[model samples]
Target: MIKEKAKKKWDLTRKMLEITDDEYNGVTQEDANLRFIKTKLQIAVYYLRMLDEHNCEYEVPWNKEQFKWLLRKPAGDTKKQKAKDWCHQCCLIRDKACASWSYEEATA
Candidate 1:
């Protein structure tokens, strides 16, 4: 289920742009274009970092391209606040689920 979501995202991101898998694998969510990556593990990290930045309530934008980690400040820096907030909320959900599903994670 999670993998399908990632593949869909990756396919969309790649539809208009091109990315190599290795480069895709290397970036953290801190990258401005982090949303562009389509892999489960990498995307998970990207969202987690977005949550952290949001939880800390940043004033600056920190957007990046996945492979090089090259970044640009988010435009208007307006959505940054909202994205950060949402990401944080998502993090809480993910964390809670992970904690409750220790049996599955432990085995993996």
Candidate 2:
């Protein structure tokens, strides 16, 4: 049930990535892409959090290092730096979720 909900949210987010130019109004392409990336990160973190909540031991496809790299690479400009920081925050939250999952499993 949680997986299904996450999958639906993921699908909806992907669909949102296909919105038309007019849909963006005054937002630039770079900003739009950053928003998309942030949304994707949020979705990934949400699933990890859900996994922790359910005490699921399934492997997560992406690691904290990958998320850290994604968070740090695109920090060239102010806007990009904001996006990078946002990704970094997501990474921190995700790491906590995974760690909590591991701790719970170990203590169980």
Candidate 3:
């Protein structure tokens, strides 16, 4: 059930992020905020995919060195840095959710 809910959330987020060229050209500040949200959702969906691929037992901590590359700040743009922070937080949330789901599955 938790997996199904995650899948549904991923699908909805993907749909929400699908904007056409015209829509992108007309983006307002609110649209930019939505894009930021979409970015976070995309990261969370990736975590969900990784968890599902490994049967919810994906060991992120074991691969910390490899994943640390994700936290590296880009050469410029504070906005990008902010986005990275948001993505990191999203990852943490998904990681906790993945662990909880794994425990639930193990006991079932």
Candidate 4:
């Protein structure tokens, strides 16, 4: 179930990024935004898959600092805040998935 959710998010983000790329007319801000989102989705998919396989030896794509940055407040703009909120939701899903794993055995 977690894998399927991650896959769906990745697929949707990829489609959005493609559309943004196709409509590119020298403006890069939108393209960059979508690219960032796509990257996050890709990482989520990877981590979720590894979790499904019970692979706990692998390191996370983002370190503690980077993940904290991803969830930080976006200055004072509503648009940026919305993006942060979406990222937080993604993190929650990944965190819940991680909690389902048996780390005790993996560490032993």
Q: Please report the TM-score between candidate 1 and the true structure.
A: 0.34
lDDT of each: 0.40, 0.53, 0.51, 0.49
Candidate 1 per-residue lDDT, tens place, 10-42, comes to: 454344334456546655543434333223324
Q: In model 4, what is the error at residue 85, expressed in angstroms?
A: 1.2
C-alpha lDDT of residue 4 in model 4: 64
Q: lDDT tens string, model 2, 1-108?
A: 366665564564345434345534536665555555555566555655565454555455555565455444242355455444555665566666566543334463
Candidate 3: give the clashing pairs: none
CA displacement after TM-score superposition, residue 27 of candidate 3 (Å): 3.9
Leading candidate by lDDT:
2
Better of 3 and 4 by TM-score: 3
Per-model TM against the reference: 0.34, 0.41, 0.41, 0.37
- Angstrom error at residue 84, model 4: 0.8
- Residue 78's C-alpha lDDT in candidate 2? 56
Tell me, by TM-score, which candidate is best. Answer: 3
lDDT of 2: 0.53
Clash totals in order: 4, 0, 0, 0
Candidate 2, 47: how far from true, in Å? 6.6
Model 2 misplaced regions, further than 4 Å: 18-76, 102-108
Candidate 3 has its poorest 10 consecutive residues by lDDT at 66-75
Q: Would you list the clashing residue pairs of candidate 4?
A: none
